[model samples]
Target: MDKKVAIVFWSKTGNTKLMANALKESIELQNYQADMFKAYNFDINKAMEYPIIALGCPAMGAETLEESEFLPMYNSIKSVLKDKKVFLFGSYSWGDGKWMRDWAYDAKNNGIILFREPIIAKDKPTDDILLKIKKVGIDLLSD
Candidate 1:
């Protein structure tokens, strides 16, 4: 079977973008095709084309998902994402990563099959954070 992964994200200070790129590289290293897009540029209609979908967005004001673009796009594509191997990742500056937890909880409730635990970094990603993300990428498409 052809292995493909889609990475969609929104970044303000580029931290989340950095995470997205690292994930893409790692997945490619594993010889799987990985396509990436900024939240506004992603086409939700094509969501079903990939069995694995990774969504990234930094925690915004009040530690919520990026509202103007990311959240709306996520809301639209999430239904199609049910039964797909979904991964959630992002960067956060404050509030103890409540946003990611809440997001993951909601995804589980909505019947999305999460590939693994959500990854979160404070501000810019450290070497440790990047390494862990790379591992997640390497293992993402596997059982």
Candidate 2:
């Protein structure tokens, strides 16, 4: 079995990037190979080879994904994600996490199987938040 994961993210303030790193470390601790990539640099073709994918992008401009990079890359890979388990995570500095909610709804509607509910941090992740992020990676590998 292929024990690998792909983590693609875009972070303007680095919060989202931190979550990606946490996830990568957690997965690697379990003896799984986790590759990290910036949103614009990630290749969908390469991502298709993994059973698990972790996508992160902080909320931007009125509760939305980073339009230029993350959004476009996500849209391109979303359709093919139906058969794979995905973990959606990000950070938000304002609003009531509507972005994560809307994104989760869209992903579900598109037939993407969420590993769990989308996880979001208020600004930067606290130790608790990082623990949750790590747990997701552990759970995904166990699955």
Candidate 3:
């Protein structure tokens, strides 16, 4: 089967959504399939069938994951992601990106092959930030 990537995200203020869109564009522009969906709009069962994934969300207060419907849904699939290659993305309003750090560790413990650090930015990503996200996208599709 041809290679493809799935993008699942939850964005309240559109910062994270912008990242998701850029990532999707980057992946599809590589001639690969990129499935984009809001976290609530996503179907996790179908996502596990994909070989790779890109998960995005804005860091909530005190560097915590957004406690949306997606969190519990993601927890159920956490173990199953052991054999999958995944990328994490999000936006931060304040404080250090501890959420991303701890999240990275947790996913690593579950055996997911993390590609680089989780992409993080303060509030909306500016031009430079999007450039970095684009680089992450290139990396995701490269190998």
Best by TM-score: 2
Q: Which ten residues in a row have the lowest lDDT in candidate 2?
A: 42-51
TM-scores for every candidate against the unseen true structure? 0.96, 0.97, 0.92
lDDT of 3: 0.82
Q: How much does candidate 1 score in TM-score?
A: 0.96
Q: List the residue pairs that clash in candidate 2.
A: none
TM-score of candidate 2 relative to the true fold = 0.97
lDDT of 1 by residue, 31-123 (tens): 889999888987668787888899999999998999999998898888888968899999998889999998999899888988999999999
Between candidates 2 and 3, which one is better according to TM-score? 2
In model 1, state the lDDT of residue 100. 98
> Which digits, one per residue and each the tens of the lDDT, describe model 3 over residues 35-94?
887777666586777888888988887787888665765676787677777889999888
Model 3 CA lDDT for position 77: 71
Worst 10 residues of 3 by lDDT: 68-77
C-alpha lDDT of all candidate models, in order: 0.91, 0.90, 0.82
Residue 36 in candidate 3 has what lDDT?
87
